[model samples]
Target: MAVPLLSVAAPAPHLIGDKAYDADSLRYWLAERQIKAVIPSTASRRTPYPLNRRIYRRRNVIERLFCRLKNWRRIATRYDRHASNYLARVALAATVAEWIK
Candidate 1:
């Protein structure tokens, strides 16, 4: 899913992801496209690359934002079947969350 999504989207200089995306193949693939992978290494890796903890800390902001959005029952659950409607609900939720912030 991530591979296909990255392929379709306009190339970004950097890609940030969680440990679940810490595969060597994925890192190599991103490197091939000149995308800097900011994913932390999994415990299984023999030798881990140096990761920028300061940059990785920024992921918390996004995580917290998603947490806030999920607090809305409509957005947390798939109440709206259509993708357009679902996206609108997400946008509305984000707008309301930002306003409240």
Candidate 2:
């Protein structure tokens, strides 16, 4: 999704995935399409992978986002069986959460 989304845009995104996406294929794929990858290397990688230490430290924002989103009981339980309905609830929840913030 990231690849396709970035590919069709006027400017590409600088990818900032975690060490999980540090494989050769992922790096090569991003580089092949002119995307700047910021995935840090694992201890086992053959060489160090470059990363922006400042940006990487804020990775927990994703976790925090989910933690906030989960405060919506409907989303947490996934009571809406349909995908469309679920997405609507997610949007509604986001709007409400924004106001709360």
Candidate 3:
């Protein structure tokens, strides 16, 4: 999923992800694209890769934003069946959340 999406997306300097994205292949893929992978290594790995804890910490904010967005019942339950409507509702919810913040 990440591979196809990234292939078409604009290049970025860094790719931030959790432990689930710590596969060697993905790391190599990102390195090939010159994008730094800020993913934390999984515990079972024999040699964990070095990570920039400071950069990885930023992912928490995005996670929290999604958590807040899910507070809207419509988005959490996926009430909008259409992709366009769902996107619009998400935008609206994000706007509202920001306004209330």
Candidate 4:
């Protein structure tokens, strides 16, 4: 999913994710692509890496955006079957939300 996005858009230097994305293979893959993973280690990890708290705080904005989007039933339920259509709806929702804000 991210690979296609990176191909279409400018490649990001850092990838921020929640602890659910904190897997060794994913981290290795991000490192191989020269992208820094800003994901915190899961509790079960033997050696937890230190995270920049300031940078991690920025993730809250993204989380809130998703929360707002989910408030729309069509998006939350994924009414669009096609990827393009789904993405379009998400873009529309985000634009409206930003405009209203």
Best by TM-score: 1
* Stretches > 4 Å off in candidate 4: 1-10
RMSD for each of the candidates: 1.2, 3.0, 1.2, 2.2
lDDT of 4 by residue, 53-84 (tens): 88889999899898899888999999999999
Per-residue CA lDDT of model 3 for 1-101, tens digit only, reads: 88988899999999999988888889899999999999989999999899999998999888988988989999999988899999999999998887786
* lDDT of the candidates, in the order given: 0.90, 0.79, 0.91, 0.85
Q: Candidate 4 vs. truth: CA RMSD? A: 2.2
Reference-based TM-score, model 4: 0.85
TM-score attained by model 2: 0.72
Provide the lowest-lDDT 10-residue window in model 2: 3-12
Candidate 1, poorest ten consecutive residues by summed lDDT: 49-58
The model with the greater TM-score, 1 or 3, is: 1
Winner on lDDT (1 vs 4) = 1
Model 3 spans > 4 angstroms off: none
What's the C-alpha lDDT at position 66 in model 3?
91
Candidate 1, residue 55: Cα displacement in angstroms equals 1.5
TM-score of model 1 vs. true structure: 0.92
Q: Of the candidates numbered 2 and 4, which has the greater lDDT value?
A: 4
For candidate 1, lDDT tens digit of each residue in 30-77? 999999998999899899977888888888988988999999999898
